[model samples]
Target: MLRDEKQYIESLRDGRVVYYRGDKVKDVTTHRALRAAVNHASLVYKWQADDDKRGLTVYKDPENGDVSSFFKIPRSSDDLIERFNLIYQTTRFGRGTFNIIKAIGSDAIFALMLVTRRIDSATGSKYAERVTRFYKNVIKNDPAIAVAQTDVKGDRLLRPSEQPDPDMYVRIVERRKDGIVVRGAKAHTTQGPVSNEIIVLPTRAMTEKDADYAVAFAVQANAPGLKMISKPERAAEAAMNDEWFVTGKENVETESITIFDDVFVPWDRVFLAGEWQFAGSLAVMFPTYHRFTAISYRAGIADMFIGLGKLLAEYNGVDDKSHIRRDVVELIKYKEMLRSTAISSAMMADLDTETGIVIPNKVLTNVGKLIANESYMDVVKHLVDIAGGLAATLPASSDFNNPEEKVYLEKYLIGKKGTNAVERARIISTVKEIISSFGALYTAAMLHAEGSIEASVLELYRSYDYKDSKKLAMYASGISEKL
Candidate 1:
């Protein structure tokens, strides 16, 4: 079912325990700090209801009527390409901020579908059946979801069970006949306060000794004993400004430290209980789907950067300068390079014969994500260079609003030939929001969001075809004679 914006907002009124700034939030949908995020997340529903964009956000499922395009599983390369378009366009719609409320949850669901099939095939378990049923319910209700995968490890060198504090990682503390009780916490649970459900996955591979920790399941965001302590909103002060672009609600996002204190998950909701061996497979498979989503959204953000650079350059009367043109071209190259990797990843996808699900090319996806992670700074550097020093030291909206200060700012801030002072200041304010205030978090997210730069580097080494390269080197160097 495709829920409209009002229905989506009302859904979060459930009695969930959420804290912000050490105070219990009475209503997330109406709270000052959280309302922007809720509104940002509701864009999915808004787009789905719009006749012009309905095709991009949703599709007719003969069995389920109209469902979100997010829940559609990819069976062929065309389907994967469609998935790419949905993600890319939605991020652009959100003003370069990807709404993970559905995109991320679906990424987890896709990974779960693929891994559970392998587990059931090897052990004759009915895990696959449970996942399908849960997936169907998600589609029918169109509930917003948040994925909680990163565990807060007390010590970097220790495993889940080996931690000085066992609760450092979320684990099954007790096994009841009807369900299992989970305890511990997940950090960086993006959009947790606004989501209806929270899907949990193992943060890393497990061993026989870590059987209790190798669990994957879904639970209500308001489940008994579950608590979400949310981080403060980013650029809160700037969002209050009267500037056009910087004040949009769609630019906000919220994350939380979600704690599960003896939370119970019924057997029906538990997808993996003690399958220690397949834990790593589930951990790795999720990022394969998620990194593709990452690169897609990053492409949209790149588009924004490209536009911002050009707009600022034109405002500063430097659009025709050769060096400025070169930098702009570099930004264009950065965007297209990330985009090409996404297209290549989809086109070179592999079909999982057992389940008939098409998996994006793993190596190419990582390569794309790596480029997005590493080259983001260069994107920022180029934008800052194009916009000049005003990006960092622009006068606040308050200054522009004061009649006494407005007179001076009006005359002094004017730019180029046709632009007014207020117009130039607004443009510079938008750039400030991106490059300095909220952009600090955004810059870090690009490097560490899906996984770290090191994580992608490690995956590339593990998955790339080094043996063929080695053989080619041997042939070229005449080392074959020794063999």
Candidate 2:
């Protein structure tokens, strides 16, 4: 069953130690930096329950008659496509922004379930069973989860075990009769503050020397000794400028430095314990599934960029300008490119016999993500060109409230004869968000979101089958005979 907004909000009071700006926050539902995002997360829950969205967001489990979200284990290509639509709809709901913390949880669990069985094959371990049990626990509880990837490597020159400071990457510190205690931190944990669980996985492949670092587990977000030093991300907009700015996006997601201070993991919760061989599998599969989802959701953001760029050109009376038309066309081309690439990737997906989950095609998936990560900055560049510099010098929300300033500011700021002063102010304020530091930083994050550009290139290079191309070239050049 889908949890309501109220249930999700009230759950935040369960003693999660969340700190922001060097201060502790008792309840995220009411905190200044967290309230809006918490509410936004709540809408995800509410959307599942909404009658109009039920067909798209909620599904009936086949084995058990329980209500489930499309975020559950996808059994076939149809299920994967449903997830694609969910990504598009959710991004549209937030008006171009995608709070992807939930996507991380679902994608991780889906990939983990498959990879653990592979681990079982390589090593005679019951890791797959443990992961299955954990899967049932999460579905029954349906807790919001934040994935803790990317470790804070103190030195780029050293491996996890070779680090001068052993705690640089999260690793098992002590072994107990029943479980293990882990001590370390994970950086850039998106949506860490508002979540109910934190799923910890390896950041890289590990060797036997790095056995302690080759661990995977799930723990409560408010577990003993757990601390989240959070940095919230909020889209800035003038309070008096635009209703869309004020109402559409109030609270945004957060990323945090999550520290595990010798946190305990019970036997039931531990999925991988010192299984060094499977570390590489975990590293590759988790992000592969994540990148598959990234391309789908990011396309919607690209669409929003294109739509806004076109609107700005029209309002600025430059729609007829050759360059402005070309800019908007380029934006549209990128958005459609991402969308088509993702769909193509999904259409030719493969299924795992053990987990029965459909996986996106590797080459097209990487290409789609590469498109968004590589060109989003260019998307921003084109939007800025169309909107012009007024986005930065626009009057503040306060000026519109002052009677004397309101008359003069609106009169001068109004664009063309067709648009009004308030309309132009609202448009300018919206444009400000796209060109601001916050906007560019988010776009920049996409480059290294799933992995860096080099990583994606490597994956594409390895996954491609160039044997036929090479053969054709040899025959054409007379290097090989037809016989």
Candidate 3:
């Protein structure tokens, strides 16, 4: 486990593990776009070691009774609540670029708790104990880790075992007395290649026939036989080469696709295998935890945008304008709604089947995610409105370098009489970078990631407590309800 942020950055600097775009990246730490994101993530680890975030970021692991990072294991309902609060706090520090790092933390912490509880109940295995130990180590020594969840999904309609291309989903292809060999690729893995470690798990619920696909394990990012592919650089990549930081906003980090080419996993690291019955339970539990985390963390992101909107409105001398005021009001309401849902979910947490990992209630968890989806988009829309047309039409940060265009940029971009022309231009370019670059992509991901809004609604519909509510309604009306 990474002992501190220094090691985390060192790992990123120590590169070259078959990560490809069109060509392989020899070292991700120095790359123009990827480096900024890596530095951003390192801040999370660095915070754990700093005196300021110690209270929020550090927690005692119940198993080893050692103080670990709050991102490690959420064992009690209180543990879950504390973690829920931590993400909200961290959002202010990074302006929400740190959201995905916490997203990975949510999945790893909750899944370890859920699975450890289940295994402890079923076979009285030390799996839960081992997990707690691992978690404590990570917390004691903060690490930058990522979770791999999505499968290549060869044919959306076909199950993993039923797919003609068996490697479409990451699955166990061979088992030996000492370990297992896995093949296939996982897509949309948040910060997979740059992370210190990667937690691997089954992508979906599985049946008995799909036993080979129901596997879970954890490994170092540099583990042999693993390859990654990120979304190709945007058309904006060319522009970034010369001026990545000309805009105050950093270039967004890339999340790569990870392929396991018959990778060997040691027996000790393998947490689950062929537990087809619990496969659905695992899949369901992941979203419950992830959605709750998103509710709080993404709201933190909206909080950032709202603050930005207010600043921009004032700088532009439009804060007193009715439309801008109205937009700010709407934005604040959306942020408040997301905050409420996340807090409610955390407050309503419960214990699970085994390792005694406390999880948020399923119905509210799904609702939390839905609220995030709706609120995130609304906040962005409001920000866009308050920002006015300049949000779209601003010149690139590079234009400031030109002798001729610099004067026009200064004159035209001036926001208020008190502010210097250059400062106004800088702020406008930063806003554009926020709205146009990979950071923009992160906002879109908040809407669709961790399952779409439609999917969340379906989950809520299935878990609705309709029967009890219906019976109560009938009694209140003095009418006898029959089955």
Question: Which candidate leads the pack in TM-score?
Answer: 1
**What value does the lDDT take at residue 45 in candidate 1?**
93
The residue pairs in collision within model 1 are none
Off by over 4 Å in 2: 66-68, 232-251
Worst 10 residues of 1 by lDDT: 241-250
Candidate 1 Cα outliers beyond 4 Å, as residue runs: 241-248, 480-483
Ranking by lDDT: 1, 2, 3
Per-residue lDDT over 19-44 for candidate 3, one digit per residue giving the tens place of the 0 to 100 score: 55577777877765466666667666
TM-score of 3: 0.89
TM-score of each: 0.97, 0.95, 0.89
Ranking by TM-score: 1, 2, 3
Best by lDDT: 1
Better of 2 and 3 by TM-score: 2
Lowest-sum lDDT 10-residue window in model 2: 235-244
> TM-score for model 2?
0.95
Give the Cα error of residue 412 in candidate 2, in Å: 1.7
